[model samples]
Target chain A: MYDAGKIISGIIIFFILVSFPIWISAASGTIGDVPELNLPADEEQCVEDAEWMRANHMDLLIDWRETVVREGVRVYTASDGKEYNMSLTDTCLDCHSPKAEFCDQCHDYVAAVPNCWSCHVDPGGS
Target chain B: MNALYAFFAVALLMLVAFFGVWGLGWNTLFAVMIPYAALAIFIIGLIYRVVKWARAPVPFHIPTTCGQQKSLPWIKSDRIESPSSTMGVVARMAMEILLFRSLFRNDKVQLEDKKRVTFQGNRVLWLGGLVFHWSLLIILFRHSRLFMQPVPDFMIFVRDIDGILQGLIPAVFITDIAILMALTYLFLRRVVFPQVRYISLPSDYFALFLLLGVVILGVLVKTAWKVDIEGVKVLAMGMFTFNPVVPEGIGPAFYIHIFLASVLLAYFPFSKLMHGPGIFLSPTRNLINNSRAVRHINPWDYPVKVHTYEEWEDEFREAIRGVGLPLEKE
Candidate 1:
């Protein structure tokens, strides 16, 4: 190579950058981890299916807040023909108590800081 | 025809990815194996191409100069244009790579009234190219959160800043919108402009279409499909650590996004996308304009046996004496 030193150095730099995730994972001493949500043992079913809720919970909550606070509508008819009151504190958090254990599990894992905590309080204190 | 070919090719890739995972349920193949293979190919191919380029010798100081060259000490020289030293060359290259200084000076010629010709300054190409590159860079940085275990504070900070307008359920990133708009402008220019269309090839269209597919699919997966974020991070982290576990419940949209991204990586070193690295090796941009100030010796030069003037004079000494020619030795 004409400029072997410069070319090799450039390749080294590029390799390091492209494989940043690999080195980072190695340094952190963990391959991968899934957020462990503490589900209630006694409860048989949530308001909706786990899969749908996993993906669309934020949208559902946002819609619920608009319906309850702005439009003064309180009843939420789930897809399975079950109806429940649309209240974050009373309906959702009543079961998934202790924000740090349930909500914060996934939220902290994904680095999502929801503004829900600013207004609502955790029923099961940390 | 070129555009259609490129579009269909990308569509076919998407369909292959979708069917491969959704229909056949080859989760490991699409999610883990393909990504790893593609990343390896990308790295190896890039290094090979760079080495191949470096092997070819640049025998001349061929810097493309636009401004005044460094001549007399009194004459002010444009360092970033007609670079005369190493520092000046570095500055020139930095501007070329970062801001695309040369493209900023792009001009379009138009025939006026079928008689007069007018050259107009065009900044649209420069603007579109700049926007696309910068947006792509930011998007890549934001994606690092999926790969990192603890998710670095800086990455989160960058993501938060990008998602400041949080009116939507899932905050929209400004880069996503910018990249889409910039890509649209770039693609439209190639199709709409007669001059550009005439020179357009399938590879050019293919690159644009592939990138467009990746971006659109990425946006769809993030917003519409709403794949399990934890599952994706696990999969991403798995790939990095070589553990290679295919996480469940990540939608087909996510699979296709990853597959398309893998295709992009594998195709990178071979395509015009190599321009990402090739730009650094460009002689016109990287070389110093110091032909007058310093001598440049060709590395390929070799020692050769040659007859000198003195030897020729000695060999012709008898002939010179017979012909009555003057000889210094005598």
Candidate 2:
């Protein structure tokens, strides 16, 4: 007779690996409450739409870094015909000042390290 | 003819990637939506294929053995090759998976001077295959840095080792070159060898060409057109977290690379590329060679009605008496 034990165990292992995200999410319970960003109280609008910013803020910052540092271009024109300074500290931090409360919230939830603070100083440094 | 079709198919895919991202500027579709869809398909399709294979009952113990079976106590058994026991089977599978033992032993027959035939060890294909697979694995592992935050130390170590020949400004990884060269060799082998070319189907060529396209695009991304690294990480992280944000400022080249990769993923299970997992499920490779030691009973075997010799004799007793023949019943 064929050994059924090994086959069953293999199937179990396959399920465990494949359904890892499900069990992990169930165990962590953080899937329901993805961390929310603390918006600035004074600022009314950003360079782009909120959804666009949420998706592509890092890319915008990266482009800003290259233009400002490499090409020495300081002004950035948004798709909405609005012009803004291309400085992370001067432009972005002016609005999203508290890095820990605002940036770290979503970043920690997603486990993404932008590595921006390594060079640039945090405005709300503890 | 099949090869030409496959070549055109691969060209079409490249064209799709090029036009989809560069011409149409559909970065979100190429980067986020397609990848997510492909991943879902890959996972589900792989699981379905595996389950379908597993459910099929292998009633016979038909293990292909290359060495002598365990029979006489005096004779030495080739445990790794024949694999009569469970441990032997495990060892055999390990060797098969890790070293590609069967491929390593590949022999080629050549007709010399139109009279003499000579068998030569064909290690080139084995070497190409081994290097291609290993390099691919390492490259995939190294890419984990893009997916994971605070990239693991082991991954870093692997990256360092892979890029040990650090003369180039961006630092060239050994696997990058190895995979390209190995893929080229494999492709060339298919084209150059008449026998291989004769047997090669469209799917075979398509898989190879697609993989080559993916590797070339990846290399171009790393070397020629640099994209926003942090943005890439952000995008990868978003995907992992189920938030899937398409990052801006990443070059169209990156979009093309990702689209090609996504297509490969989506096509993986349905194509001949499924041999990666199918190798494990192969009864010839996985089964133990213990037919001599134990009788293999088919699980589906059931009893059936049959006429016995005694019953036949009893029915024919009257005819036998009439013919003056001896009967045990009478």
Candidate 1: residue pairs that collide: none
User: Backbone clash tally for model 2?
Assistant: 0
lDDT of every predicted structure (CA atoms): 0.85, 0.78
TM-score values for chain B across all models: 0.87, 0.87
User: Tens digits of per-residue lDDT for model 1 on B1-330?
Assistant: 899999999999999999998899998999999988998899899999999999887777677898899888899999879988899988988988899898988876768887788766467889999999999988998888787777778878888777776655355788899999999999999999999999999999999989999999999977788877777787777776577677777778888998999999999999889999999889888878888778776678778999977898899999998999888887
For model 1, the stretches where C-alpha displacement exceeds 4 angstroms are: A118-120, A123-126, B107-121, B302-330
- After TM-score superposition, the amount by which residue B219's alpha carbon in candidate 1 deviates from its true location, in angstroms, is 0.8
Top candidate by DockQ: 1
- B119-146: candidate 2 lDDT, tens digit per residue: 6646888889999999999998777656
For model 1, how does the per-residue alpha-carbon lDDT over A21-119 read when each residue is reduced to its tens digit? 667767877556768888988887899998778877887898899999899999999888999999998888888987678888887767776778887
Per-model TM values vs. the true structure: 0.88, 0.70
